[model samples]
Target chain A: MPVALEIVSPEKLLLSRPVDMVVVPAEEGDIGVLPGHAPMIVTLRGGFASLYEGGKVTTKLFIAGGFAEITPERCTVLADEAHPAAELSKAEGQRRLAAAEQAWEAVDKMDVAARDAALAALQVARAMVDAAEAP
Target chain B: MPSLKALRIRINSVRSTQKITSAMKMVAASKLRRAQVQAEAARPYAERMERMLSELAASVAGNKAAPRLLVGTGKEDTHLIVAVTADRGLCGAFNSNVGRAVRTLVQKLEREGRKVKIFCLGRKGRDFLRRDFADRIVGDVSFAGKRRIGFADAEEIAVRITSMLNEGGFDVCTLVFNRFQSVMSQVTTEAQLIPAPPPEAAAAPEAGSAMRAMYEFEPDEETILARLLPRNLAIQIYSALLESAAGEQGARMTAMDSATRNAGDMINRLTLNYNRTRQANITKELIEIISGAEAV
Candidate 1:
């Protein structure tokens, strides 16, 4: 049996299909899931998630921090922000990276909570750049 | 009988008013469709979040270490009422209904000797509540010029409420908004925000029940709950905003439709009166001419 993988953002559902495997970017580390995997909930960091089918990567999605709920038969990713990696252009990524860097530089002026949020945003921006440049 | 000139002017004025009402009705219908689509799209995320939070909350039901948001602050003497209404007012009693609900709630709370703080979301609610509850009014947030309601607007309100909660501004928070039932109906509702309400037993999905027993958290449960509680608050606010947006459009559509029909009826009546008056004048003139000729 294939695992049902669903990626949902606040704006809309990006993907919902039965895939052979899914690699989620958990907060601690990347976790790979196949059918019959143990049920777990993980906090997502800023990175790309790879959905596999027939031993090939079917799609890669850039996800910002959120949560992943994994059941044995299904995996649902509720991302704070998510977009298809293919939609992230290099130029756009670079622009975002610069903006994030500028914001990070001003993080010192913000409170502890705002600074932490800014750091997460910067990491997501970097991940976007990495996803855009990947072949 | 009224003069023909006066009746003709009245008919012309009524015709123009009917034209405006008909145009408003069409505009409201289109806006309602868009708002309905957006509200429907936002439901899945909000429902899923609610479900997940409820499950986690169920597990930590008796734990003392659970976040303050999930568990109450051990006091309920103070209440913060967030009344959400529309910025504009042509939608019949949509705003007034919400205002009435809030007013009733406030009166009840005050009678019970509980302190109440009113936070108005839109201008209409603020204007309505300010008349009687001016001293109780704390803050007002308006999105008057915005063409569309978005998550960002909700987030801003959530942030303000969270900050106030952190400062121990109020013991309980209640959100008052119009729940969109259909284009013809909207029911005013009050949802508790602070000391979040316990998840209902039926909220857990049957399919996820088996997996629920074996689920493990990556970090600690407390850590996840702490991070999730604020986000859940924001999600709840966002969904409420979406519902209010749809409700506003729905109410507007219904109100405009009635207004348009009423204008049509008035125009018809005015035209009929105008024709009758003109005929009376013509008949009177012919009768007078015949009378003069007969006398001669």
Candidate 2:
């Protein structure tokens, strides 16, 4: 039996379909799931999540951060931010990377909490740049 | 017995006012459509967030280590009331209704010896409440010039409230806004924010049974909840803002429609009076002419 995979962002649902396999960027590491996986909830880090069907990659999305809820029959990713990997332009990614780097340099003036937020944003920006450059 | 010219001028002024009101009604109608679409689109994500959070919260329901956001500060002496209304005021009683609801809540809480703070979201509400509750007003946020409401605006307000919560400024938080029912009707609603209300039991049994059967937590439930509770607050605020925006537009449309009709009625009455006065003047002039001819 195929598992239903759904990728939902706060703005909208980006993807929902029955797929053979799904790979998520869990906080611990990238984890792959097949049909009938045990139910679990895990935090996501900034990275790309790929969906597989018919033993081939069907879709890839750049997820900023979010949570994943896994059920026996469904895998739902509630993302803070998400976009199709293919739609991310290299130029735009580079621009964001430069901005993140600039912000990181100036993070010293901010309070510890603000600095941490900036650091997280920088990490997400880096992941987005990498996703945009990947084939 | 006003002069014919004065009555004619009044009728013309009313006709122009009618035109303006009708135009405003059309504008509000278009705005309402967009607002309604955004509100509807936002529901799915907000509802899903609530559902998922409730499931996670169910696990840590009675845990000693649950986040302060869920379990609260263990006191209910202080209250923060977030009142949402429209920035502009041509919307009939929309702003007043929300303001009145908040006022009533504030009075009741104060009567119970509970401290209350008012966080006014829109200018109209702030102005309305200032006359009575000026000392209790803490924050006055206005989107006076914005073309439309956005999630970022809501997020900013949420962040402010969260910071206050962290500072132990308030023990309880409540949101008062108008819920969009239809173009002609809106229901004022008050929802508890801090110490987020547990998911309704009516909605829990089936999902709870399924979730309990198979769910493992990573990095423990406490950490996930610590991050999620704050986010849940933001999401709830965002949804409330969307509903308020839609309700404001709907109320404006209905108000303007009625205003246009009322103007039409006034114009008709003024025109009738002007015609009657003119006829009377013309009859008097003819009678005087005949009387003068007979005297000659």
Model 1 pairs whose backbones collide: none
TM-score of each: 0.93, 0.93
lDDT of 2: 0.85
| Model 1 lDDT tens row, B32-125 | 8888888887777777777678767766778987777777677989999999899999998999999999999999999999999999999999
User: In model 1, what is the error at residue B280, expressed in angstroms?
Assistant: 1.0
Name the runs in model 2 displaced over 4 angstroms: A89-116, B201-203
TM-score quality measure for candidate 1: 0.93
**Lowest lDDT 10-mer window, candidate 2 chain B?**
B201-210
Tens digits of lDDT, candidate 2, B123-225 = 9999999999999999989999998777667767888998898899999999999999888899999999998887884265865777575678886787678
Per-candidate DockQ values are: 0.64, 0.60
Q: How far does residue B144 in candidate 2 sit from its true spot (Å)?
A: 2.5
Q: Which parts of model 1 are misplaced by more than 4 Å?
A: A89-115, B202-211
Lowest-scoring 10 consecutive residues by lDDT in candidate 2 chain A? Answer: A109-118
C-alpha lDDT of all candidate models, in order: 0.85, 0.85
